[model samples]
Target: MTERLRRALDARPRLTRWLLAGPGAVAAALLFAMAMPIWLPKGAAGIDNIVFPLILVPLIWAVVFVYACVEESLLRCVAVICGTAAVCGLTAAMAFTGWI
Candidate 1:
């Protein structure tokens, strides 16, 4: 690891890093799940809606996991994750309200 990377990792508590990173990954997944019904085209008796989102969920989570781990600031990581969750929640709400 580069000196700066090592220093960044060393500066935070391991548990705190995990706490932030874990939720960021989980939020990414939930975002994908929750957004599926809202944004996916409903076709073939709804299989199309379910299939693509399920396929993308892990990809989304992996990307978010890496980003959360590599990001330099804990607060910014939390902000990104929480913002993602909020957007997902809002989109799901819109679906329920027949807005999508």
Candidate 2:
């Protein structure tokens, strides 16, 4: 193997990757689960809005997780995760309070 290839293969994931891929993915998933119910405008078929999001959130989480795993910058990863979580949590709270 080439020296570059060997080095690349030998490298381990850093703490940022773990933080983003783990907690970040969880945060994104929480948003998908909660925010949609509030943020999704009402529709003809009442269940579709909720059901469709439930189906879609896992896919979203997987995508976010993969992106987080590959993201090199700690600041970006934290921002994305915390930002998403805060938005979702706030939305969920507002909905619970009948503000939505």
Candidate 3:
């Protein structure tokens, strides 16, 4: 079972790399941005939380994408991206549920 899983994971390196660098990074970045408002200060004008995330989205995406592209271990790369997305997603969910 483990061997089959390993073979599947190793089957198409290029596709996996592209998937991680593209949609995976985008999803993580967007989730992080969405969760940012929960933690970011509202600033004097009370718009920083909104503005900052919008401004930082591209930078966030680029950084995640680059890391996914350059990381040596694919497992580690997936873990990092998925972990980030999961954390941010949970944060957003908690906020919506008024748990935070």
Cα RMSD of all models vs. native, in order, equals 6.2, 8.1, 2.3
Best by lDDT: 3
lDDT for each of the candidates? Answer: 0.74, 0.73, 0.90
lDDT of 1 by residue, 1-100 (tens): 4565546745775765797568757876777587886667989786888788778888878878888779877656656777787888888878878887
Candidate 3 Cα errors over 4 Å, as ranges: 1-8
The count of residue-pair clashes in candidate 2 stands at 0
Error of 1 at 97 (Å): 5.1
TM-score of candidate 2 relative to the true fold? 0.74
Candidate 2: segments with Cα more than 4 A from true spot: 1-13
Q: Clashes in each model (backbone N, CA, C under 3 Å)?
A: 0, 0, 0
Model 3 per-residue lDDT at 67: 99
TM-score to true structure, per model? 0.66, 0.74, 0.84
Better of 1 and 3 by TM-score: 3
What lDDT score is found at residue 30 in candidate 1? 73
